[model samples]
Target: MNEAVDEAGWDVEPGDEIEPLVQAVGKLLKVCREAAGLRVAELGEVLGYGEDMIRKMERGARIPRPEYLDRADQVLNAQGHLRAFMKDVERARYPRKVRELAELEGRAVEMLLYSHHNIHGLLQTPEYARALFEMHQPAYAPSEVERGVVARAARKSVFEREPAPTLSFVQEQVTLERPHGGKMVLRRQLEYLLEVGQLRNVVLQVMPTDREEHAGVQGLIEVLKFADGTAIGRSDGAFNGRPVSSPRDLRILELRYGMIRAQALTPRESLAFIERQLGEL
Candidate 1:
């Protein structure tokens, strides 16, 4: 038993749609180990994982990290058969909401966003994100925080798409000063905001807290527009906070978002404001 290894990190949540795939992978892993003439404990020793942990993995009760598969493939001499499951496992490890949002973001030609409490996931740096997740009320396990951080970072791929999306962000000024991950993390996040604000496809605006007329007081708002002319939007303040796709419903969210943008600092000015905040740090 490798006492030093942390093998109990990720598990397939009870109702995840990926359960069948994980089960299949788990059965395949067990088959490979048995064919190689190795017992569970023997395989665990070679993999630096515990026998109990190995049982959970073979039973489809846990999600294996990519490195685990890579090492398992080499140890079992399965010739990458085990390694082949890494991509699916990686996707399975992310929360379903993150996966769905990432898919929508991938298809979006434009994204309108307003963040009230924390830095937007797409804009958050990994360190800052990890810090924020670690502060969750129940106190997330270290594994959960890492998974969240990785999922958040993965969504930034939207920024790299060919024919980049027109991303408009309206952030509350308080998000700039909150220091969710401590001062250094906040400083890096501010610096990242400055860097991202320079992108031609992205418009980053900051809403001053002093404004008497604020439309975003309701909560976070997200609107994604697709190339096929369809759009989906959701805001905490409207429609029970459910996603709205009907033109009329989207219009309401859009109207409020337009006002929020109007009340926010201009993109160039927001960048300068962020720079000043960074300097103060």
Candidate 2:
């Protein structure tokens, strides 16, 4: 395999302060291209991307699309490097908490999600995502909002993957009823939810506002189960509201989600519930 080194060369020196994830795939791509004795223009010719795109890929300025990555992997004869790199890039696209969640998501055979304050990130449409970002308490610059919007939008692709993981989501009734980004945007968001809920891999449940003892009262929790039967759970704690994740913590959260699912309407009934909520709009 062709190898390259950091600025310090192959010498064992100080670690990379920039974080290996920053330019990891980029460096790998550069090395892979060089090893194949292919120029940027030559590689671009095969991928139908511009040399500039290839340059950005090597510079870490852009993350390659899965299709592009797959094709490049085949063309470069790099085994599965490009495909693996895409998964890494997808994880790196989000905040540390989000990245951790995404890593867990990829390994997960099933996910249990609860959202009370807003739509679950994975379920949000672009317009809805934009609205949520724009409504940030401290406010975000347009560029920052765009970045967040894209990151959240990209997470939706998990559902499209082969052997997709099972997703079970419960949202508070009020969240669905509250309109964000006006009527048209809310309508589109609801429509997207309805359409996505029909997927065989997805199960959406709605928790009624009048539920006597809502399990989600503890807060939003996401529990992910792996094929090995190992599970991780995350929740927002007090203080800074930083996320908490651990197998033990997840067990507690999983029980709570189980209760919430029991309390809420069934998936079929929830679909009807969402339809009724949408009709109110």
Candidate 3:
């Protein structure tokens, strides 16, 4: 097994201990640069990053983008060790929003999700995730895409958690039809969906375009129910574009998501529907 996978299973809590992981990579980078006898400005010039960005990365305040890591690896002749260290840094500093979801996911007894435009993050394969990120209309640099993909993929850890929370997703049918990553990638994505859907804890429902009234037209929402039966709902634009977790607000979102699920395919039927769509593709 990979060392990273082994560490991920060790119940590594997100806290002060992460500081050392961050610092180690930063220190390694600084040492490599000094050994190369290169100034920060000189290294930045070679990497095409601002000197400040380099400084922040070396200080462990910001995640070094993959391009920076790749260049550092090549320039410092560190072989693949630096690349491995960068992955550890990412596991430490996942985006705030992704981390929030991951924490909630860890505690939730169940989850209800609605995605209108894109595949729900949990269901994405690496290639599909990359294709989705690359489509960022303005286009992301390769490093940006790698960071987003790793963060997104890492969120799937929820599926492997003990007593995994039940997941019910109401995704628009159009999302599957758009073909974001071309035929083969979409095929693999659909296959991955099938594999995940078979997990006892998951429920996936596809919202058809023919629906007369769409509950998700308002946008994406995620509702989580904890062991206490307490629930929280997060909407895309609610709370100034933050997740809405107040009991009252969560109740409202839950009601709406429930309505959306009712309007979509049933879990068993949804699986067949997705398989049929895959066949058509």
Candidate 4:
């Protein structure tokens, strides 16, 4: 396993806590495969993965996708035991920072977002997210890109949470215009934005490119408010671009965000703006 890890050129190592869980899952997979009388190559053939990938997964050097586990469960006749680890596998697939952010999002009672660059992670479509990752400067591996797409798409689950969070987003006009994933992807993204904007609990606004009094010139801003009135916020435009949890710092962010909202188009107007962009596409 150490030799494989060294040869694979993995950029990041799994944390101590996560390593054990993945190893346990891998052990179960190996045991199930053996019980089913299937060789690693045979299992790979059945699951559409390579022999090396199957070996890596069994050795816990690779994290399996939920669908992979589901297929493995059926193939190995583990009943539901293998499938039961889907949530853990999914959580492990994401980078630690993303998981932490997702945890905060899950606890948020209200989420306020202002995006000046690209669409917010919670709002991005899978295809769009994939395209963005594909174009990353360092260039993620295909597997890593796929993992990111899935992780980002999973974050949209926040919208479906019961006792739904009050969601608000303010997107810059340029952001809508910039085709991150080509025209077709952009069109779908706009349509999706329009669709999500219609939800009663969501407020989607647009800050036009022509705005002279933009309050969010500092960049992207996000504030997640919890049930107990506590909040966490971060801004690309803020001091050193660090996250802040203090009430005073949060209030400053709130003030800027409020002003940005005021300057942006109303939700209805933003929807119409998006519609126009879709038509132009």
Candidate 5:
């Protein structure tokens, strides 16, 4: 393996659900390399990967990046066979919980989000998200942080769905002032928020720190309602923090979120507030 590969922050989570799929793909990769009469080192040289990475990927011990599959298809003449796994591998690269949340977001026609200390994942810019992940308590490895950034970014597709969903966001005022990724990153994030806030189906609000009675004092809250009349919700201070789908449980979350919205600045005022913040930067 190349020196960089040895140090690269890529590792497959033990007992992950993606283990079987990765292993299967890896075995095929090995077969393809052998069929093409390429030694592991030779393959590594062409693919710009270290032998260790190549071997790990081939053993299904690592999730291959899409670029790896694409390049491998061309190098080994697999005729797109290897490329077919890109989507699966991409999904495998993230934790299953992130993917599950993304799936729920995709199916929802209405989403209500509240943030306590940071921007919601769907609203965060890639750079901002990267900075946030880089600040994790244990300090995520470069590869792990990259995975988080990609996963967060993928959730943004909700904004462009053919039938646009109603997206209501309430952010704590401190989230706007805190420079999570330095001043430049915060500036860009505010700019992006302004752009998104202007979308027809979006309602963005800010909850001020001075508010005497805050509904969101409980913490972050999220509720997504689908076209089929089914809805799911989760809150930091409710139900032991697990997601709830029953009408009764959802009612509790909705009640809290409704109050949060009522307590926040109106959408128009919020945009003006963001613009003012940006000007100060």
Candidate 6:
């Protein structure tokens, strides 16, 4: 067991506190496997994972992906117990801040965004996200970069929710041109933007660099409106740069976002512009 633990990368002391939810999931996996009379190695073979990985997952030293829970539920005949824990497992994979943001995003009924720099997180490709995290000022470790990439990709789940949220984005032309992760990465990103733009619930516009009068010159702005009539906003132009939820502040941000959307190229035109960029690439 000690050798297996070391192989699974459990660098912490034995008494370290594991996340409660993760521990709960591990217990559930163990109970189900035992109840089904399946040994760890047998279950690992059934799931196409190594015995050490299964043991680590059972010990709460590692988090399993959602699909893993589904398969475990089937193989262990735990009915829906394992599958029911998928949401908790998924949440445990992300950092605290990302989990909070994703919660807010999940509850949002609508999102309005103006990006003067990089593409919005929800719109970024995995390669693009990995590259961006790798280029962080202090430089992220490989594991940190992978985690960031997964977290960002997880935010796209909003697009898959029932009665999908209304999303509107205005991206600066210069942002599309700047190869943050080099030309090929940018090309795939632009292509992805075009794909996401075509979704019925999404409105994507491009703020042309040639425009002299830009409403969003102040900087990136994001407004998320919830189903309960409350909203939250953040912007580079805001005095303290903190997220604001006051109705007055939300209204002010909405007004600016509205103007930016109006001034930018229409969705159809934006798609054409992106296509042109792809051709140039």
Clashing pairs in 2: none
For candidate 2, the lDDT comes to 0.75
Residue pairs with clashing backbones, model 1: none
User: Candidate 3: what lDDT?
Assistant: 0.77
Local distance difference test, candidate 1 = 0.90
Write candidate 5's Cα lDDT for 141-189 as tens digits: 7877878899899889899898999999999999999999899999999
Candidate 5 Cα deviation (angstroms), residue 86: 1.3
Reference-based TM-score of each model:
0.96, 0.68, 0.73, 0.90, 0.95, 0.78
Candidate 4 regions with alpha-carbon error over 4 angstroms: 1-12, 45-48
Shift of residue 56 alpha carbon in model 3, Å: 7.2
- Residue 240 in candidate 5 has what lDDT? 94
What tens digits encode model 6's per-residue C-alpha lDDT throughout 96-133?
77887999999999999888888889999998998889
Candidate 3: the clashing residue pairs are none
Worst 10 residues of 3 by lDDT: 2-11
Looking at candidate 1, what is the lDDT of residue 264? Answer: 96
User: Total clashes, candidate 1?
Assistant: 0
Error of 2 at 58 (Å): 11
Candidates' lDDT values, in order? Answer: 0.90, 0.75, 0.77, 0.85, 0.90, 0.85
Q: Model 2, 135: alpha-carbon shift in Å?
A: 0.7
Off by over 4 Å in 6: 1-18, 27-84
